[model samples]
Target: MENNFKMVAKTLFGFEELLAKELKQLGAQAVTIGVRHVSFVGDKGFMYKANLGLRTAIKILKPIAKFKVINENDLYNKVNAIPWENYLKSDGSLAVGATLNGDTFTHSQYVSLKTKDAIVDRFRDQTGERPNVDLRFPDLKIDIHIDRHFCTVSLDSSGESLHKRGYKIATNIAPINEVLAAGLIMLSGWDGQSDFMDPMCGSGTVLIEAAMIACNIPPNLMRNEFGFERWGDWDVDLFEKIEESLLSKTRDFHHKIMGFDKSPSAVEKATQNVENAKLEDFIYIKHEDFFKTQKGGEEHLHMVFNPPYGERLDIEMETFYSSIGSTLKHKYPGTNAWMISSNLEALKHVGLRPSRKIKLFNAKLEARFSKYEMYAGTKKTHKLEAKND
Candidate 1:
């Protein structure tokens, strides 16, 4: 049998390219990008590596079965045929989830329930034993994706969402998701070459992720567990070797990675999170309002942050965004400033023209990530051309 198998990595919108690049760097083969996902071929070790290293992937799934279906019965029959015994024991537990674009399946929960029934019934009919359902920690997590009359059943090789990088225990009011934070940092093209800052550094997610990227630290090293750890063929020795090899490649990051938040509580939380990630030596956090701040030095500063999005309108968003624009233009010359916001109307108030803008999603709200280039000249008129007369 072929050790190489197909796997799909689900990602947020606009992160497909970043996820593909991450998979490619980690040695995945035949990588192809799909809408909100990327498929590739890799062995079990590669799967584990992807789980550990892919910064942009939300989850990794291994497709085991696919079939055409007319209705719920068809879905049930298709799910029942998969060899569940090979993946889990009769005493093992399972969780089932689904996505849909089919007429027969109106509710994802019902589809998930049907899929679970099929898996449990198969085991009961064969060995007279049924597995228990444990949604938190399942022996086999199954995914059902229905598009039209076609349904695909897959094993969730990633138990928890990959965003749970296991580094963050403390959080502020608006801590960014690990995957999204990493993706945003990578997209900013800050390759650990210069000083970095996250002004509204609630929980210091961006700072910690940036340090990890700068030092080449494996994101999942602190993870409590990986789904593949429960697999029968898990080779601890091989995994340890892989971990060691990756660790050996990690280089030291010398530049300062700093964070600033307005709230003292936020500063405390960010500092604690930084310590939890074992990165206190490389990162520094402080309590300060971003708008009132200026650059620490004359060096080029690379900043990536998610400022308050008027969640409660405590701060006048128009003034807040304008202050962000004013701070960059007046206080932060020689800096490349980037921010993401779900409040599109408020974003326009930041008058400095953006050099780049990308569409993204912050949870359920649509968001935009925009970049502003603040050149190192007083009353800077942006990057301009000399008049030739």
Candidate 2:
């Protein structure tokens, strides 16, 4: 218990709660939620597990110190005074990133530069050799977050963002981010007990993430590297054991997972991504427009998709969105259809009041994840009645 330390898992906007839940389920203690962030207590082995397992998190930061600073010099001195040697060798490479949210610190780049100079200078003064700055492959990645007058110095434990799950080698126009896609699926509350789908499954990100969730596969199992791999106290054997334990929990998913896209190129790219993730047997992709498709069989269905938002003028945004509603209501029954779009006004054209509307950020654009329930036959016809009324 003494070895357990506080760590912050950063996530996309509106995914903090999902990340917190994931951490708690993964055995994280003292779980606390913040804006786009979750704080928890875990030991070294647990840290590796979190990195390997957490799907909603963007990065994991291990805080080393926290203090209030009035100016940039105070920040530099505070950062330099820390024992960098413990984390980075004199000959190793390093990178520093800073985020500013106060009037005093106007430029984030300048703050990062100052912090870098201090650390390199300390190494030069002591060992006559300073660590080189290697932004691409740093021995230690440092994070400086300044909120108001408060500054927190931390070590970035998840390098290159957790979204780079190492399975996506192909992408199409508007292919959704892996982390955002996973969070959306989790938020939609689709357990593996039912048939799952992503109608417009460009690059198969959502479909792959869905299969992983259904079978309890760690999101980052295909990732080439995790930030903790470079830590001074990395334990390879423990990480292997953790990996084995996580993989051991995998279960069979009996429901069908399907995908469709109007573009044949998109279908090809998505199929390639599916194969890359080694989930080809679990997912099926076809080149078909979502609006022209229909649900079959007596199975209940759960769907999550990102149709073209017309952000770059592919089609009439309103008409396209309306088509989404018409397709779901008339074709897909006994199903819960969820879609996300930054075009809120166009979403109004869907004409079906959402059962759940959640605010989420797709990259920098603010979007809404809204759900429309399609009942079997005239059953639960209230949605259509409400639409007509």
Candidate 3:
């Protein structure tokens, strides 16, 4: 209990509740939800579990200090006063990233530089040696967030965003981020109980995340490394035990998970990624236009995908979305179809009313995750529900 500390798991917008629930499920103490983040208390083992198991988190930060600062010098002095040796060795490398939400610190880069200088200076003064700044692969990654007059200094426990799940092969096809992909599936409320499909799957990120969720597999199990691995107090045995514990909880997924892409290159890439994730046994990929594809079985198919929003592709979005609605209404009966799009105007052209509209952000663009339910029963009932909606 004495070793426990407060940590914050950062997530995308509209996923606070999801992350909070995840934290609570993971046996975190004092789980509290904030805007785009959740704070909880846990020991080092729990921190490792979070970075490995959290599907919706982008990063996990363990705050070490919080103070009120009026200016840059005060910030530097407070940071310099901390015992840097306790976290990083004098000969180790470091990296600092900053985010500012208020007028007190308008420049994040300058603040990061200042904070880095303070830490190096502290080490130099104490031990006559200083840690080098290695931004690419730092031994210690620090995060500084200044919100209005309040400032937080935290040690980043998930190096390089947790979205880089390490299983994705580099490709030109821009897929949805892994963290966002997992969150979208969670928000859609799919538990891997029924058949799952990603109609417009680009790089198969949704399919992979869905399969992992269905089997209760840790999203970051395949990650190359985490920030805590390089920490001074890193315990290899403890981490392996946590990994084994998580693996033991994984359940078998009996339902089918599949994806379709019009582009052959996308199909190949998705297939390769699924293989890289070692989930080929669970996911099926095919090169077929989503518009022409039909739901295969009547096993309550659950669909989640991110369609092109006309930002990159030159296709007619209105017609594309109309085909989506048409396919769901005609061919994909008894399916709960959900898609995210930044183009609100194009979404209006889908022709079917969405049962639910969740406000979310895709990167910097504000988007909506819309749900359309196609009933298996009488057309009259489906139309009545649509009319009521």
Candidate 4:
């Protein structure tokens, strides 16, 4: 359609496919996956839907201009040539953020500052006033991406990252990012068909994300605002219609969603966050040491959690990981367990061999997301049974 424009949805490493899948499911066009990003075509309403419904995307950007620059001076000149008045009022507030992929632009901060200067200069020259830089609450947020000499300037449609789902008012130490949590759950192939659990649930992020995914609820439905909401062409009616459409598609989840934490304060915080997300009925948060508990019922279980590694890999972490393996191996039978941890040496202490291992990152630290399958009986017995079948 003529109204459709290109947009780039940024995501974490190893999540490009997940984001692309989400965009397609949300009705985006020409979906293409890139490293840590996905590009697609969509109308303004689809843009709003992408921001609200995408579970793995960090932010979405609508490119306004793309050019090749010889130097910073050329960048400034080209940026200044674009008409800023079309997007932002001369007296409005704005913010600029930049990313660089080549050695030509060694510092991202310098690029961001130059872009801001160019836009401000354009407004100042044409209207006798310029928008002030407001990093926190900007009326317009611009994103600059420089790959070698190529530059693409875009409007950030999602103001803050989409992970700020507005439901986590309280947090425990090392609470997982909501986008990453949701991606991990999808990667594990859980489709709301069976019981879900986070044994070491911190702040209940995983539990909340799992509940949302299970019910097909939009991840950002509770978000306070998106960058497009502050755009000059913001459409409240269209956005509301999109929201209603997403809500209409949400399905009821029959399986239980559960979380457990050893820390009382962590349990309290997770409970509060669950209540904040209005998922108390679907999600049950408990104060229990995971290692001491046994799996209940004969139904299958899907478990995903990120265990704490403290400051570094130490004796305690090794013991903690060993206990995790032992607990799953003995008590938590008939379960498919997944864990992400950056401590490679400590992970070796887990006696059970992982059925699958995928490289991922937790913040800046390189991590591995691994899966373990515990059978109802011994592995040998299960294998024999499978052979008979």
lDDT of each: 0.89, 0.91, 0.93, 0.94
Question: Judged by lDDT relative to the true structure, which candidate is superior, 1 or 3?
Answer: 3
Q: How many residue pairs clash in each candidate?
A: 0, 0, 0, 1
Largest TM-score belongs to which candidate? 4
Least accurate 10 contiguous residues by lDDT in model 2: 377-386
Per-candidate TM equals: 0.96, 0.96, 0.97, 0.98
- State the number of backbone clashes in model 4: 1
What is the per-residue lDDT of model 2 for residues 285-354, given as tens digits with 9 covering 90 to 100? 9999888889988788999998777775488888888888888888988899989999888999998889
lDDT of 3 by residue, 107-140 (tens): 9999999999999999999899999999999999
Model 1 lDDT per residue over 1-389, tens place = 29999999999998999999999999999999999899999998888888888889988999998889888888788789889899999999889989998577789999999899989999999999999999999877888898888887888888899999987889876668998999999999999999999988998999999999999998888888877777777788888888887788799887999999888988998898899999999998988988788987889899999998977437788988888999988899889999999999999999988989999998877999999988877433433532331
> Looking at model 3, which ten-residue stretch has the lowest summed lDDT?
166-175
Q: What TM-score does candidate 1 reach?
A: 0.96
Ranking by TM-score: 4, 3, 2, 1
